[model samples]
Target: MIRWNVVLAGGIGSRFWPLSTPARPKQLLPLVTDAPMLRDTLDRLRPSAPPERTLVLTNAELRDAILALEPTLPPENVVAEPRPAGTCAALAWAASLIARRDGPEAVMVCTHADWAIGDVPQFRDTLDRAAETAATTHALVTVGIVPSRPDTGFGYIQPGTAIESAPGAAGEVRRVARFVEKPDQARATQMVADGFLWNSGIFAWRVGDLLEEIAALTPEVQPALVAAGTNLERFFADVQSIAIDVGVLERSARVLVLAGQFGWDDVGTWAALHRVRQHDGQDNAMSGPTYALAASGNVVHAEGTQVVLYGVNDLVVVAREGLVMVTTREHAANLKTLLDAMPAEVREP
Candidate 1:
């Protein structure tokens, strides 16, 4: 079956402030490995879908940078959104393009460009299985990550009855019962105990299936999609900004969930480095020349300077471009608030 990779790589990623700026966002930074996160994502997807079939949806300002980073990708394939129209509009436009070029039966494997995924083979296997399920069942398939923790940061998916897999299918597929928003700690714990999967945002569907679903269930984007035809700017301008989950998947009946356990982490905040990156014996995830003395459970990223942390626990220390930011892991998640309180020059830099 023909498969296309659609990567959503927008946003300046304010959570990673002091390091992530408008000119160089989180996806372009080498947060996880030596390479940029977007580069890593593209490399991982290259084995399944070639660079020609890969489409990256990013901000208009980031288009040139993305193109420069991913030189192998066709210039046309790097879609630049005129405005922030959210994932529904982005995916709809991508599906329209795929349908016009590769026909309706082609499956689109969707993922974000700023995630950290372990077990590359298993991740590809899961995507293949989701693609197969989407093709055979004509269902919008979402890969729900098996919860490694009761993470209150992520949304949860409730799987309904099991669906019979097609011949030579990879794994189990189930109908989605409901979508739950981010819950409180107690609720998250209860949901995890009750068999809820973290909404990993990995999705697959035939171009036609997605288009049909958009037309049927998504009023927020459908009219603009139909009126714009091939004009991406017009579509973005007219379409209401809404996430794909809220606009289509949560409301659609043809949604299927495939449980995936390939060590997926969104790497959403500075604290996330502790989970994705390798740690020293003291459980400190460090990059560049960093030393942790009498410290444990800390995340430190240093660039062009040495960072030394002492007598700290669960703290985040980042040094870049002559700027140093030190905060507890708990406070790292709310860097946007700190950025808002700071001067524009300091915040942007």
Candidate 2:
């Protein structure tokens, strides 16, 4: 039994441009299905915990918009980060709050709000198991997806030794040998062959255990514990920016990874629609007033207008009121480069 808190919803998500604006990011868009990606994430967690226990950490600029989108959650539960201090600070802050409200024994399951899990039941089961592993082992646990393909986009986790079988379950808990960032094509293929699991960025830990790990591994946010109530803004401003994976999980000695079988995909780019969304017979993902002809393996999303595509293969086509973007699906992951190359006036709405 764990109380989960989700984060990283304020991003502009330029990879899903046109539909994804500064006012409404990808998490707020119905990228995969009818509901927004954030909404889907919240719905998935409902079986494990209620809205009161689940906190949403996001930027101040998008706070009101997020609240408007998810009016069901308590306004207070929607935490507005004073600044973008990265996951190390954000997770530390959320863990501190959970420890204060609930007891330090409270287990917190942390995840991003913009992912797509194919099987809801398996997702819940894996998360519940991870929570148990965290509570009993007192170790920081991360869910590693059983890779179905050699995905170079996601990080890889190497399992060390099996700790114990998950009480009557088929597979056992395992010690994490090492964490590897996104690798080259050959390395990714070899890793898949070597039984590597995709690092799903799903984490579980006791509030107290995580706080202690932050104190030991991440000195950047350590001071915030004392300044939390007094000067929150100054505390966030002063902390060094780092992700939890780099600051704590990678350095900490007490880390474990559990193999997750549920279909998981981090819909981080336009190209990811192929993995998460329903495709046609020719392998095209069409959404929001879109029609494809002679377009194989393409992703087309129209925000408020009709988009007609023809003779385009492996392309990402998007059309909205103010803008339209057309590019190869292979280049969809690197939209930042396109944004960087564009003029500010044209880029900004």
Candidate 3:
């Protein structure tokens, strides 16, 4: 089966505000490395799926910018979503396009545009395994990251009965018992102890399988998909805005979970930088001209300016274009609430 890489890159990341604007969202910004997170994601999948086969589904306004960032990708492959319909609509559209182009047997490895993957080789291996599993078993496969900590920010997946490995398969695959939403601290701790994996949002399935599941289980998306045909704009207009996890995967009986252990992080907030980016001797993740003196456990990103932290810890300081923001690591996670309280000019700029 032909393998396709489908990247869902359509969100304005409000969590990393001040630095991440609508025009230049977190996926386009250099959060992890010198290159943008989207670039890193595309590069990571390049070996398995070439540029021609890789599809990026992003907002209509960001389509031109996405093409500019990854010039190697075919212009037609950079799909422009007319509106902010959720992942269910996005993937349904992508799967329809792929099915029309390459037939339904083609496998699509779906992932978000922004993530921090530490071990590239292992990540590729796991994705390859997932694609193979999807192809062989014809089941919707999601790669669940082995939790390094009790992170209350991400959803948890409980693995059920182990599916006996196919001959020569390298990893274990299990039926999904249940999916738990972001729980409280105590619940997260207990779930982690019980070997529940983080719902990494990494999925693989044949275009046929995904479409079948959508038609069978997702009434919110199925009718729109059937009526829209190849009309992208109509599909978005007609579909209900529901996440794929809720609309399809969680409800599908054919869902399978595979454990991934390659140091995966969603990079959801500014504080996540400390875990993904390289840290200094003082244990601070510094970018641009940043210096942490007598301080530790801080994340500082400076643009066209110098930032120095003294006698402070667990702070997130971001400076760019004459605007400076300082907040505790704890508060940095809820930048949307902060943005709501800020003035229009300051928030937009």
The lDDT of each candidate is 0.93, 0.85, 0.93
- Worst lDDT run of 10 residues, candidate 3, spans 163-172
Q: Which structure is stronger by lDDT: 2 or 3? A: 3
Off by over 4 Å in 1: 167-171
Task: Write candidate 3's Cα lDDT for 298-349 as tens digits.
Answer: 9999999999899999999999987999999999999889998999998875
Q: Can you write out model 2's per-residue Cα lDDT over 1-349, one digit (the tens) per residue? A: 4466555565678777657777788888888889989888888888788878888888888889888877878887888877788888888888888888887888999888899989999999988889988888889999999999998899999998887644325446788899999999999999999999999989999999999988987887787666656455766878888888899989898898888988889998999998889998778998889887877999888878899888889988888887888999899999889888898887886
Question: Candidate 2 at 254: error in angstroms?
Answer: 1.0
Worst 10 residues of 1 by lDDT: 163-172
Model 2's alpha-carbon lDDT is 0.85
List model 1 lDDT by residue over 82-101, tens digit each: 99988999999999999999
Clashing pairs in 2: none
**Candidates ranked by TM-score, best first?**
3, 1, 2
